[model samples]
Target: MSDSSTDNEASLHQYQDIQYSLKQSNRKTTSLFIERDGSVTVRAPLPYDMAKIESIIEQKRSWIYRNLAEWEDLNRVQVHREFVNGEGFLYLGRNYRLQLVDEQDEALVLKNGRFLLRRDHVDSGMEIFKNFYRTKGLDRINQRLTHFAPKMGVTFGSVRVMELQHRWASCTSKGDLNFHWRCLMAPLAVLDYIIIHELAHRLYRNHDAKFWDAVDKVLPDYQRHVSWLRHNGAGMGL
Candidate 1:
């Protein structure tokens, strides 16, 4: 995939400097987010000026730099795993060891405190793990959405588990929800945070004050989960 993001840099307050990629969109208000690759992206409505863009980034300097540092620190550590006996795999916030079997009855299954995978699946351990997450995650995510959607005053559409690279979850404008299978690795509370985060988007589309206010209504301590994901997201992959 090629990134079409271009860098936008200008002067800042008190001799500080902010450089970011400006993505003009149909949305109202300016929204800034740091990408997984450590690039800054700012989305603003069209017909905006450079001075205005700089001011918006300036106002959120603390947030920008704080998350930038978090991004840098996240990529500093690496998580590697070999699909052998006693090797650990994360599921629903706990590490479960792989228990490979010599039967080809199925691709993957979790039973009796271990991830029971067929011996032939060893070569494609990543796919086996991904399948485990998708098959299991679909059930868990739907049940949770049914419980939380009513409180949000919104009816959720089809909830699917997939490979949503670079994002935890996404809610389509049409009311459907899609969650990354990797999200099944996080704790239940963190999973709820991801669910509530997307459901809130059905009401407020941007990360503005009103958008956060919607999220705060459900999960007041959402920041902790956000921090957890930011710091530990790199390790979530297989």
Candidate 2:
């Protein structure tokens, strides 16, 4: 496979103390992002020049630095796990030890406060665990959505739990919601926050004041969960 982009040309550009990749497209507004790996990218309208893009970057300098610092802190506690007995895995913010069983009809099951895995599936344990999360996540997320949708005054389409990479959850233009399977590893409250965050997107596409206000109406103390995910996200992995 090869990489191709018709919307924008990517090149490394620097302004003062900031170095970033500028992506200009037909977008109506310029948006900045700190990628999952901590690289800076700015997407601006096609008509904007380098000077204008740099100015936008300068305006958001403090925000960029703050999020980059948090990204650094997140990576510091990155977790490494092995598919052996007594190794702990996270489920709803709780740690459950792993136990390999010689015989089981299913590849994995949570029983007696521990995760029981079939011994033969050790090599493909990651996918098995992801399947477990995705399966369980769909039921839980849909249930929560049902409870919260009316409160938020929105009707959603289908809900799915899959690999969303760096994002916790996303809402489509058609009102469908997709969540990362890793979300099932967080606390129930945090998971609700994730759901509400996406549901709010059903009303507003951007993270503006109105979008946040919609979230505040449902969960008053949502910032703590945001901070929790930022601080603890690294450990929520295989």
Candidate 3:
């Protein structure tokens, strides 16, 4: 609970641009977290010595290396689309290259197994693409929610579409279902699985056995879709 490092003679307290604190936990080991503002904090038991904790963190540098490598891999694979020619987009779990064209009206046309973005009249091609997908995505989700919510004997107050960074969909205690707009890229069955998963939460808030049982009552093979989302979710992000 006290600072034990006494190598410095200037002052007992050392000034670091980043300060580290050790927290007491029930776990046998320590963990480190780098905060958003570039501060590093280590969590460990209160009885542990500061010098030993620092040594342990140094010994676990391999974990830091692994995490940095994962971050770099995610950054490399997460592609951002510009809604321009040659940009790749996903529809129904398949990839298609965007082909931009000058036309009288803004439209999304599919031809020759490619998505054509006719963006002559649209002020912002990206906005047009987003709006188009939003509408279609909302429609599909609404249809699935309506069909599944009733079967699960759960009534939802509202369903809304928005962009979520961390989750594909979430359900609030008030019976509202919120889905990410990027879910449009998934297949209809996959989207339905997410909807059903959220709707079941209306009955059981946490992912307990009862919740999973409720989900299995509706979707017998929900694991496959869940696995697909977990593995390929990053590519769905903008």
Q: Estimate each model's TM-score.
A: 0.72, 0.73, 0.66
List model 3 lDDT by residue over 125-200, tens digit each.
6666667667878888888888998899989977778765456677888988788777788887888888888898
The superposed Cα distance between candidate 3 and the true structure at residue 54, in angstroms, equals 20
**Which 10 successive residues of model 1 have the least lDDT summed?**
6-15
Off by over 4 Å in 1: 1-62, 65-79
Q: How far is candidate 3 from the true structure (C-alpha RMSD, Å)?
A: 8.5
Q: How do the candidates rank by TM-score, highest first?
A: 2, 1, 3
**How well is each residue in 19-75 modelled by candidate 1, as lDDT tens digits?**
566666667887877765556787766565557767777788767654453233333
Q: Write the per-residue lDDT of candidate 2 for residues 17-72, one digit (tens) a residue.
A: 66778786676888888775667998876555667777788899866654443333
**lDDT of candidates 1 onward, in order:** 0.76, 0.83, 0.66
Clashing pairs in 1: none
Clashing pairs in 3: none
What pairs collide in candidate 2? none
Q: Would you give me the overall lDDT of model 3?
A: 0.66
Ranking, lDDT, top scorer first: 2, 1, 3
